[model samples]
Target: MRDNEKDLSWWQTFKSVGAAFFGVQSSTNHKQDFNKGKPVQFILVGLVAVILFVMSLVLAVTFVMPA
Candidate 1:
């Protein structure tokens, strides 16, 4: 946590977005995200995470349900 480094890394962005998805993001993190994150990048990452989540659920259901 260096003062010179003000923005989150890609992995940190992903973690922030994931916490947001679960509606449990801390206020401090939210503030940091708003201050340091790029909107388009966050949007793109969020979309990708949502799509992957849906795809995984579909695959799991396909595999588990009696056919």
Candidate 2:
């Protein structure tokens, strides 16, 4: 590993994933993620986030629409 690269914690990974979802991740963080983050961890978190987002949209539509 490079001197600047270190393993990312779960919280850091989560935040990085969230930032990516919103397309607002900084270049520094992006580089860090690529350097230090695990691909499997990012994939799993992204999948979960997508599922939660879809579920929330479904729930909102269900509640907002007439029966």
Candidate 3:
């Protein structure tokens, strides 16, 4: 670990993953995430985010195009 780097909390990991989902993560944050973020944590959060995103889309479509 570098002198200024610290372990990322779950919230931080989620925010980082969210920013990545939007393709808007800053370079500084990206670097920090690589340095301090755990790969497993990121992967777990990313999976959950993807599931939620897909579910939201399904719900929106069902609502908009009723049977």
- For model 1, the stretches where C-alpha displacement exceeds 4 angstroms are 1-5
Q: For candidate 2, lDDT tens digit of each residue in 1-67? A: 6877678888898899999999999999998898898898898888999999999999999999999
What lDDT score belongs to each candidate, Candidate 1 first? 0.90, 0.91, 0.96
lDDT of 1 by residue, 6-59 (tens): 777888899999999999999999989988887887988899999999999999
Worst 10 residues of 2 by lDDT: 1-10
Candidate 2 vs candidate 3: the TM-score winner is 3
**Which candidate has the highest lDDT of all?**
3
Q: In model 3, what lDDT does residue 18 have?
A: 98
Compared with the true structure, the alpha-carbon lDDT of candidate 2 equals: 0.91
What's the CA error at residue 19 for candidate 2, in Å? 0.6
lDDT of 3 by residue, 39-58 (tens): 99999999999999999999
TM-score of each: 0.84, 0.90, 0.92
**Decoy 1 TM-score against native:** 0.84
Order the candidates by TM-score, highest first. 3, 2, 1
Q: In model 3, how large is the Cα lDDT of residue 61? A: 97
